[model samples]
Target: MSDPQHSNGWRRFWHRGTWWKALLLVVGYWLVYQLIGLGTSALFHDVIDVADPLSSPASIFFGVALPILLSGLLLIVLAASLGWARGLFRRESLPGRRWMWLAVLLVLIPIVLRLIGTRWSAYAVATVLAILALGLCVGFAEELLTRGFVVNILRSGGYGERAVLVLSASYFAIMHAGNALQGQPLSTVLGTVVYTFGFGALMYLSLRVTGRLVWAILLHAATDPTTILATGGIDAHNAATAGTSGLIGVAGIFSFVYVAFALVAIFLVTNRTKVAPVAPATSD
Candidate 1:
């Protein structure tokens, strides 16, 4: 017979649908982000404009700094408030191996790109680092809410991993479209989707191997900001049109190479290492 406490908890979990709960979390996060964006714009009105979040110093501060510090703290607090069973903002259930090399590859990709052709202008350096920081925060927030919280909840309720991954990754990729309106073209958006989804798969793999969220978070922070560095500046006016290939015309082909590399690497790593899946409860 099941324990009374376990039965009650299961009842509570069912009473709360994972999708609705996740949707609410996403909405809450968006609202908070909007408020932060507005507040930052107002605070730095003289030095920055909210219209172009990328170009605005205030927006940069908000995106890179505020989200990390403020959102992190709030997530922690909120998690604690929700009680231990929910694991708060923490992904107390990771399921994969540590694959630190994957993260190394992500960071190295941008550095190598710089070595090959991209020159490091002072502005690009600052913007790139800022973008990296921004990506980390972006990853932290979205991953926690989407993959960390929502996926786990659904999985606990008997959802299939394949479905959960597809849904989560699709949502993640589409969210990048906000950048599209700011001069990011369809191709760039497509590239972003491919790369970001690939990252999600990596994170999913990480979860499967180690059963923890820490590695995924670090990988995300490392990978994303580096992508910004590869792009250099945030000058939409200088970007190529849909039909015309831009300065980094090799982007598409290069992406294919990276994807190929990623697949080969994954096969090599898993084949060489017999990493066992960590069960959910003990993963985090």
Candidate 2:
């Protein structure tokens, strides 16, 4: 019979390696995102740089939209190029009916939030629509990279389901560290990371239960920009916060509330149904 200690040691070995692997993935992707930013800056050099973050429509549009779009496509391309391409980008990989429900949830959640004690000005309405579209645009890329590619990479390398879920979630959080550049407090940034990690877990569970990336992606995309739109268009911090709000200010309150709602949704969906775990591979 196999020694129990030996089996435990082997499991620990993979677990430790998986954490390190996740660290590397986070670091590597940060570099890739930075490069994309630099490239986009060079490519879109002609856009006027408004003096104020809140006033600059171009900056707001670019900030909210570009990262969402690039992160998704970059991961898909990187996955395909690196030989880990698993048809994640294809429509067939998504759960149809479940995803449709999720899409409705995604769209409705924001609309409902906007209607609740929310003031609607002409510019705010326009901003809401623009922000919603921006969220959807980038949602695909973020989910592809964080939930889709990262999980698959970990699984193929002999990690367990729990390990893959945690690692990928952590990776998602770290990648958003750049939010600090926008004047986000360390606490808010850290909270955002943790909250997003939970989101990542929910996405992973959804994918396993449904065997489709669509619902998870749609759910992931909706909560964020929707909350932002409901509150108001991107704030100074969002447009690149210039160090105004402290640890628990207006933006912080808004962010905390948003994250809380996301957690509630996760609790609801997960408790309502059991997610099937992806089977461990015979060979990797």
Q: Which candidate has the top score in lDDT?
A: 2
Q: Write the per-residue lDDT of candidate 1 for residues 1-284, one digit (tens) a residue.
A: 54332445633453344655555555566567656766765666665544655564445766445645566556555444333234423443434445634544553454344334443452444555666677677667766655665565455445455655555555555555555655668887777777666556556555555455665677666655444444543323233212123334444354555455445545544322222211123211
Task: Estimate, for each residue in 97-200, the C-alpha lDDT of model 2 and write its tens digit.
Answer: 34324424433444454444244442444556666677686567777766666665565456655566567776887777778886778887877777666556
Candidate 2 backbone clash number: 4
List of clashing residue pairs for candidate 2: 68-138, 72-141, 182-241, 237-241
TM-score of model 2 (CA atoms): 0.64
Q: In model 2, what lDDT does residue 222 have?
A: 73
User: Residue 120, candidate 2: how far off, in angstroms?
Assistant: 3.3
Clashes of each: 15, 4
